[model samples]
Target: MKITSIKLPGDISDESLEALGNDLENNSSTLDIEIPLNELQSSLELNNQQKDLAGQISNKAPRVIYSTSPSILVVIDGEPKIQQNAKWGVEAVVNTPFTLVKSGGSYYLHGGKHWYVAPSAKGPFSMTTTVSSQLRKIEEQSKAEASSENDAAEKDENTIYKIIVSTQPAELIQTNGEAKFASLENTGLLYVSNSSDDIFMDVDSQNYYVLISGRWYHSKTLSGNWEYAASDRLPDDFAKIPEGSPKDHVLASIAGTDAATDALQEAAVPQTAKVDRKSTQAEVTYDGEPQFQDIDGTELDYAVNTPASVIRWRGRYYSVDNGVWFESGRATGPWVVSVNRPYAVALIPPSYPVYHMKYVYIYDVSPDYVYMGYTPGYLNTFVYGPTVVYGTGYYYRPWFGTHYYARPYTWGFNVRYNPWIGWGIGYHYSSGWFNAGFGIGHRPWGYWSGGWWGPRSYRPAYCWSPNRYGGSYYGRNTVYYNRSRNYNIVNRNYSGNIYRNRGGIVSRDYRRADFNNDRYRNNRNPSWSANRSNNRYNDNRYSDNRNDNRNSRYN
Candidate 1:
């Protein structure tokens, strides 16, 4: 369905729009997003009040106004090390002596103030400096050690070599061997046998290694000189692998390693990484113009408005609240926190990214260490802009869209009328009434003294009753306002309704009705009914009284 107009509160600011646009532009390389100047301007105008409401909402603790991708952690030498892989350019282990630099599309590792170059991951390393002096001396002296002997045969007691895992794409190194090792579907870790198999190899920035044949063997390259490793010599990070991880299988295969593995696992798992599977279920409510699309090969319908907060896709209900995502099988959900967000979330149709881009989380790194995966076929089908292309789920589009309905008070802004633009001058909130102000004149008494009707008139019109609980009474082809609390009285025609504009929305409330409808069953006001059998003078007098009361109230 097309949304004709949207009414926003007056609090949203132009500055928020500018900042959002700037963020999108700055991250354009990683997130393939381009916001046309006109679109930005329009969104700013439409959501002018969002900024003011954001501050009010954010004051509540635990409310997240914005969210960034979660940090990635890779265990090294029995300790968990944070990894920064923003934009997927280079994965660098944080807070370590080692750093990675990219030149001409090739990555070089800098460790202990020395540059180690490798053509592809599998490398016979040669120490060289194609870089400047500042970087050459960029070493931490305390952490730095002298270069090791070139010959593999030579061993030094003082030289301690930490096993570095490779971050390069994992390959099926051995296919027909006694045991098969294949890359897991989403994680970079290699699965030794099957999904359930405990044996796995963790990937790091410079090396990929697995505990194989009861020995810790890691390679800087994909294929390796599977060097023998002493259990005590292994880096503390290696022990940080999770209980079910392929790295854990190393402990299972070897004796007396379980105790160490357990300790590392405890330290490896971050508090944030723990998924809260239980979540209180809430009804999914749509607040904006929801565009409905069918899920491929499913009877389910998916609805999205710009910055979609609620999504129904693939017969499942999904929603994002306060940066955490929840999912359920039904629209009215007993939701569970989604540990592994499904691929369907990333494929939430082009309309979502085109409008509500900020809520999009397709390329975010989840607690699972893998980037939230997307369907490459879906990305290929939807085009964000001419130059922006998401190739094979490797890229993402930056979040855009105004926070028009971002606040809790404004969360359920759904109205039946045109949502994109204003419905001609019948008080802004009148749009919520079904077919409000359409085809009908603003005159509660019908064509009064040559007043213009419908869209042609600029004069303020009264077409809806603001009382949400009030009922609309139809008699002799005319509509009357009936208040629930005062059933003894009825508003003849629409004259009792008061219209006032707040923000862009119009609110209508009815004055107390003095005349009882039951008493005037036979002689009801002519304006309240099509039949004018009642005396005109009596009707005119009542009309005069109502008009005087309305004028006095406004005055």
Candidate 2:
């Protein structure tokens, strides 16, 4: 006799379902329509008993176990289960499948036929509600499989990834304060960190798992929940962290006292230099006209000719064009013109300094000393040492603020106009000559000397080019320039071109009569002396190199 399908009452409990299956096998020889009828009557009785037990458990109200650490706990049916490991916060409970089920207001874990409740991923657990209908179906399916297959499925549930042993260390790059671990040698794993302190690398699908406090954890996504990994079952990567690597503590925990002393004694060096990784390129998206260029020092692709030329650098979007800077919180932007430039952009090294440096001088105004000819009240309290240091060559460290160091343009570059003071000049190197104004005597060879061609007594007027509707508002078209009685405003065009009020064309090549040498090579700006004096004023230790031409490209 063969039982094709067993149709039981819809309200039958999971326990009753299991028992009914058992009874069918036992009485197979005596199988008939009468056998199922007998078993159904007995199953109904057992279902009622299970319901009563469930009610009792619910009424008891799991007891809360308070822990000093961030972990929480509860007692269900007199069995204590921890939702979080006190040391590591949330962690996977032993023998519990790594599946989370959400019902009502709380999240529960499916432990075969049982349901365990926890406030979060890391849980102090307690057996609470009955198996949910969704979970019950899964459990029922598992029971139908053969015993050998069931055992194999159970083993697979505990295993996270297949381990592959490797001898080489994973190559890592630091960006946005997290280490990005990529397999440069094709170890076939990619991992990023959510926490700077707790970083792990995977190799051959195993090893180099992270151990925090004492518990082991693994994750596929950078910000994903760290599932508990058994220490005994951990892959070989954990054992391979070079002895002197910053992750030496992880090795010590795994290898115990038997860890190699030589590896531990190696000097701990911080990886400050940004590594060039092939996989770190930003995903580029074009909204309008397509313009492409490679941004130096980063894997970002930039659009330079677009109306709002944008580049994604270090996971942030920065648009630099038309002498104004804009930033966005996302990859695609309704970009906002940054009044005070972001600290992260200031930290960009010299390799990508052109775009950022063009605007750095605008923020150089201070109460005591005004570096930029305009914007009197806007002070630069963040930047330090615009000074030349001996060892690091040129240092512009931010001594005490959240601001990133915005280094002055110490290197020489030829341009007809002073980008620091002129508002109309497009900030690009190629566009500087076209928008040239009267020479401000702010030479590129060194710092600005106090002598600007514009009237010293004049106050700067904030001018903005017309927007799409031909109206002026603070935007990418805005610039701050000296507006005195001598220069009367003429008609302004819709394209933001300023025509001469007095009819004579504004000279593009207004060279300073006081300087005879070519503007490109000659250091005609008197500000170099002021910069030299100011450099010594901040730190007298570097006064000996006052005359040293080490930093000069001309020398």
Candidate 3:
């Protein structure tokens, strides 16, 4: 028997979900059904690779394990699961959306690990709630485009890409209405937010995954939990990891003190540089050991983009920590950088089955994806896209009960899950690596993938054209001088960002002057600099670069 949609009702906490956990061979609410006859007969023969390991994971009924416990851990358990092309040990569809679900009070979990699922994208971001879903997708946009117009358009300084949860998913919640729910998985791990007493956010203990250039590298933890050290921790020997030919084995290595940390060690990563990337802790070694070994020269002064100076938006600044849109100076803070991040988006886990709602961010908007926060273990459960409510969250190890009917829109690509922590989708180049197009898997392979060496430079010439609306808010249909159809405007007055299809312009000087020299050198305004050296800046348009993957973290 095939299962369609199953909804449970209650004031469930994430902790209860964790109690039941992933391997549900015992007491719990389960949706057991017979596999469809046609699907059973249609099971295709496995290739040599999967066939060799079939015995190890060979049960045939593809099942998605949802825990009702607060340790909300979601996954696809049992033998013979249908997920064949998972990049990380988990399995699920690629490029889809999920919603967050919430109700009762905040959810709770006791020990073990819990995963939550949000029903929409707008989020139910209360720390009191359980963690939720993740969205994954496979895209087919060609890595490189044939267009070779040596002369690109000049940029304006008013281009900005405001990244909030998509209105589409937000609308889903408004229309479908919200649901105070529970999961089918009985008694699983769940995590409850702190009760009336405020729990001090775990600055270091919370776990996170950071991906750079497609290659995933985890941080070294002194304890099982993260220490959240500034870049100053690296020894002076840090430098760039040399490019190794594909024939050479790189990406996954146990480099002693030799790995180059310059990119991460020497210079401070520019604010503009981190615009479209993700990073996570790799392996947990040297636990409880002194992590900072003073090579004397190894440690140096690192840079910090405080919530104070670094936070800006429109022509104003807003404190994102509390999600308040108040202008800068309105709320001053050296907001703690705990496991939680500022604007980059967050997600709930799928492993757990308890309710209430889960919150996460849309790090990559293209395929539309968000990774569940405070990742525990990389279990066999893969994330299946979410059902929208407030936002979307995918299921962990989704049951292969959904029909395999090919959608009218199909991306002919495959998912490859490796034990290695880093894995993502992107269009490819003749060269042997990938680029973290935008969000989702923010990092790419550093070697042959030719990781972005430094922060991208987007000046005035790359600013975007104003959207058809406006004229009321800013008092003009379009900023004057930028009337010319130039594509170089990069308005980063807020967080330093280099966005695509950016629009608008506000620089009077840029609008009037010839973008051909270096007379303008305002460290504050990057567009002014690009407007002068129109030569180098125009030559490298962001959209021009060849990003192989769908460019969407979740589609």
Candidate 4:
């Protein structure tokens, strides 16, 4: 029998409910993505808006745009961080995601397939046939590095995308030539079939709609300025998008829909644990000395120079590593498992960089053990209003002092949510999505992997990589993003204590048949469940671990 769906009773016991959640988590893998040819062609072909923006920036010296087809967007912060390429006697642009080098007053950007050149650091770059011996050596080294990445899955040259170089934040939205609309059966909405962006048009209003992070934005036309369309104000047909339709995924962004409701219920379910304080220890490393930044509306200060989510409140320093909380007196510490986290942590708003830490909780504290759990929000999945959203829709600037400490971003990488993979990046298929081939170690993955801080001994048991092009280097190995589930907190395994050998991994061992034997399985404790204050938000609106009222915040 094909089990289409199973309807469990709403009043299921906590243990049975979490056991089912474990089953779902174990069985679920990332959605294998294949980008449409139209979307791929559209990304390569710049629209009038992009062209106008390029022209506007051309007047600004060393702040120009470079265009290439099916290319990865290489973003640089302010001036390029140039480092000595002593082997080739060239200065390499070390800070950006891709490999860019300066040789003889000209800049060359290598995009795995082709190298682009221009007169300045930033440029109206164009393809050049002429190549210097030094730059050619760099290209050879890059290819050799790509070859050694995963021999079984070597990147084909045909799959290589050209490069798009940008100094400021920019996202590409293009329709392959002109916009093509496809009508949905029995629905009054027409969706743009030629674009990767979730675009739709209401037949009644003739207004264009776009979905981003579960928020609806509307415009009179595709090129016009957009305004937010509240979920409640959206047309009734948005909720009626039929299941399995090409644009049916948009239903999750619509309030009161079955898809949105399912997402909300899933968002409340957490991966819980009984932590042994004596055995579990969290280590935090700073780039240089420890630095702190105040979280808006909270008295607490978070460590901005470290990847480990550490906060200082009332002179006490606390760190949440992998779902386990640890505390110490000093910023750098002989850390011990924490019994109680700061109450002020819940006051953290979406704007704060460490706002995700608010989702990490401490439920009960005994002498030797502290019961703790973290919701999907800790992994950047949040229950926003009536539906669940991937990110907070706020851009947290990455710290680039001595070492780069990257914060979770809302844009740049096209982020989308799938029930199977949680939040994954959506991009033109086969396009080099942050395919950093220049230097192996100095990539965006390394910065995001908490290279600046974390439990040093921990590593992932396995990697769940469904998308070949989404592969990113984490630590020493190539861990591919099923969108952006790379280095996910839920993907790790735990033994004696949760934080003991906590490492970066997407452990396939987590998918075992026996949920009872899984150390990291969702555990529900009677003590914690009764005292739910630990998981409560300031407004007492929703429970992080339990299903709340079905009232739609949008309505």
Candidate 5:
């Protein structure tokens, strides 16, 4: 059934209705559903993704497994890496995805609805009415810090979840109770409507299929010995999934489809810039001494301790900071900007954490400057065959030493792709999900010198911007600067230099005063609007879908 509108009870508080309206507006990709308030019963249900509304029909308590973070990976595959929160006088579970802390011989696992308590780290956890005040304070502080970004309503007391804790690579696949199937029109495939996961069953073999990071895995039943299914080799019925259908999001994962073709085209467009060799600088800071790890199957070693993507190739260190390439003789460098892309970088496999750096390309070089460009791949969006997917499907192991260093992950943050914003974390998953507790040094968890790498800062430019097509909250929105695709990078307001200089990196006495002229000449804010020509994907179909409240699944 096509979900065009949602019906609500008339008695809903104005504040609650307002919040819901704002949420639907922000996530406009989900079709416009009219929230009509009819006199109804006590319980309420809503599914914003599929635009489904099942309200006031029965008193059955709806249960959902809302994962706090996508697969929360702890270093080892067992008990989590626990650390002492001195101020709170409790041992905090620092590694796993959930908000778990221990005090007075009892461990508390904070779910969105209720706190589950157990005596040990491994628990037959049971629902608890009371918890330590310290745990309560920690939870409150987390919510307060995230208050600016998210105002997620709490789940009712009737909400239930089967708590599963693990340190290894694991995913939580859940249904309300039992799996329910709904058929796609004209296609012989049946999809699991009750679950958030992309699960489908083939009628012929009754085999179940799951899509993760552009790779499909199939099994005989819900619980199975799953095996890989190639996207190109998938059954022809997959291509029959309609354009505006509920399960149409999966089209991007299938090879040779229109959605997949669009994604590939987007990945080809690069964010280009020209840098001054003398003024632009680079630096690297390690947790301790510089440590190196081999990029399997390549003659390259990447710096493991620092957030910077520093590579050691043939005794020279190369780093890419905000799409500009820099090279130095020493590991801890007296560095200078470099024009040549490291040859070994191309050889690094996708499974490696820094593999994304391979996409950073050096386009041209002049006597005093360098021209560089990077595709969306540098920002963790990659072309997987005919499609572009977020993050390398491989999970790189995180490094934990004096300071914890997290690697880029494929899953966990509820990443969604859109033609307008590129890729962004869902609002429900974006806010305060990573800010659960402070890291060891009293800094934000996963803090790094480079903002975009790892969990240091999860805010993508588009998430906070008022405009629909992203903004300068990250750097110049790639689209905003595309008008000057051939312009020198220094002419723009780019703060990419890692080294701290006496009068800031861009010295006032610098000869090229014309570098500041572009802003005054154009009278355009690089952070905001762009010329219509620069917006390559300004198609009427996309605008019509947004303006008329219709569901057009382009991503």
Candidate 6:
């Protein structure tokens, strides 16, 4: 039994429904995609659009796009926060045309349904595409199975904190097993722990940057640039933390003196000489930073590995997870870092930026920022500098279209193809038919034609590549010229139906799925969805009619 799916306009004939399914099975995936003659011919004839000498868009092989497909069990491998904020992993399928992916051992059903892995190899895993009585039962089953699997499987190392600083001037740490850096400052420590562990971390030291990257800096270190006292947060109270690790539910009051030895004295004076003592449990951690002074702390809770020298942001004590000392503000969080600083700092309202930047670390002090840099034998300079070994993305911050991504140039096209099949189809149909269907883009795995101008065989050879050889895209209005209301239609193709390629990859534009998650990926032409909000034309009705392909190949 081959499984087929379709989304119809509320009411559809059994014939049309059967036709759609057969079309998918016969023409698409060999695993079981069918198609009918009527829809197939109509779809093909609709694809070939004869414009400036045959525009871009030719047939290419479709891929095996298997969405959750009402599967039995969706195994989340060790639970690594699959639906993370696009910082760790790609977006799991939340909707149709889901990109094939797995996270935390479980796959995201079209991006949402969380299914668990089965125990006995593959006993059972099923769900319902439609929201009916059976669907609810299956959904529960899936959840139960997942929970069982979670209990049995070994989880990913979430919130790992190794003793980065070992009572030495130089100590290193790692983030989510990725980046690495040294907490050179005598006073430095990372705080915060959550369920997910594959978090990246880094210390943003943009302010103290000297001759770090390629650019030769006149300054040297943080102490040279900013106000570096003997210690930043050392206070005038009892100092020196106890030797053992912090146990749970123990009201441990730590204090900080200007000097470690001095702080130790204050600790000795203790209840005898202390004045204006905190009536509450609000005791300071090392270096005078206040932690849950009131929270009862038993000794077995935290393995007091290193001294406390954390960057206090907002009210949370954020620490890096790995080698790269990134930053966080929540103090308590699944911090998604914005900046992967080998050394970054947090700035306050009265922030005194020792260097030229804002808010200290990047990305709202989320979790540990993954360092996008080069490894020793992995990165160097061949063009920029003979020995160029500078950081690239350190300063490059691209938001989801809100920030500027690395856009050297942009290519646009008008997919001028007709969607309707007048009298017949196929060879006699001629003039307009696209391989990947009529309306698609080279960016979205659609074909490219240099507008019958560039090299005839101008196929993209690289990934994340734009068709520079010369090509054009057709607009949804290509069929009716903005006048025909009966235009937007999806019929059928000969060689397996349309399939989804990868989305939300690394792109020059932040809004480009290259950078954004599928949650932000743009659906093609969109006007036919019957919803006004789904219409792309509403935003640029006038500009599109002129020539979106940039090459001016079409009217």
- Give me the candidate number with maximum lDDT: 4
Q: Please, what are the lDDT tens digits per residue for candidate 5 over residues 248-276?
A: 66776789876576566656655445567
Worst 10 residues of 6 by lDDT: 407-416
Considering every candidate listed, which one attains the maximal TM-score?
4
Cα lDDT tens digits for candidate 3, 1-555: 232211111222334333334334343357565766654443322122222322222111111111221111111122222232223222332222111222223211111111222232232222222332211111111112101111111221111111122211110000011212221112121111211000111124332212111112223321122222212232221112222211011112112212122111111111111111122111111112211211121111111212011222222222221111112222232222212122211111221211111111112121211211111011111111110011012122211232111111001111111111111111111111122222222222121110111111111111222331111111222322244443222222211222221222111111112233111122111122122111111111121111322334342
The sequence of per-residue lDDT tens digits that candidate 1 reaches over residues 320-437 is: 4323355677654566554333333322333222112122232222333211111111112112111111111111121112211111110011111110111111111121111111
User: How many clashes in each candidate?
Assistant: 36, 19, 182, 8, 2, 101
Worst lDDT window (10 residues) for model 2? Answer: 266-275
Better of 4 and 6 by TM-score: 4
Over the stretch 442-503, how does candidate 2's per-residue lDDT look in tens digits?
Answer: 21211111111111111121122111111111111222111332111111221111111112
Q: Which is superior by lDDT, 4 or 5? A: 4
The parts of candidate 4 lying over 4 Å away from their true place are 1-72, 83-95, 99-112, 119-121, 127-163, 273-279, 364-370, 429-555
lDDT of 6 at 408: 7
lDDT score at residue 494, model 4, on the 0-100 scale = 16
lDDT score for residue 338 of model 6: 26
Instruction: Please give each candidate's TM-score.
Output: 0.20, 0.18, 0.18, 0.64, 0.63, 0.14
Residue 348, candidate 2: C-alpha displacement in angstroms: 11
Q: Per-residue lDDT for 9 in model 1?
A: 20
lDDT of 2 at 116: 61
- Expressed as tens digits, the lDDT of each residue in 1-555 for candidate 4 is 122333232223556656667676666665464777764564444233223322221111112222223445566644676767555578876555456788888898764456778787676566676889887887776665444432322333444444555655544444544778888778899987766567899999999887765567788877666777766679989887766566665666789876676667656555456666677766677778898988765688888887677899889898887777788999999898776666666666666667677677665555655666666667666765676665565545666665555565444444455443445444332222232323222323222343211122222122223332222221112234333434321222311123223532111111111212211123321111212332322222122212111222211
Instruction: Report the lDDT of model 4 for residue 292.
Output: 90
Residue 163 lDDT, candidate 1, scale 0-100: 19
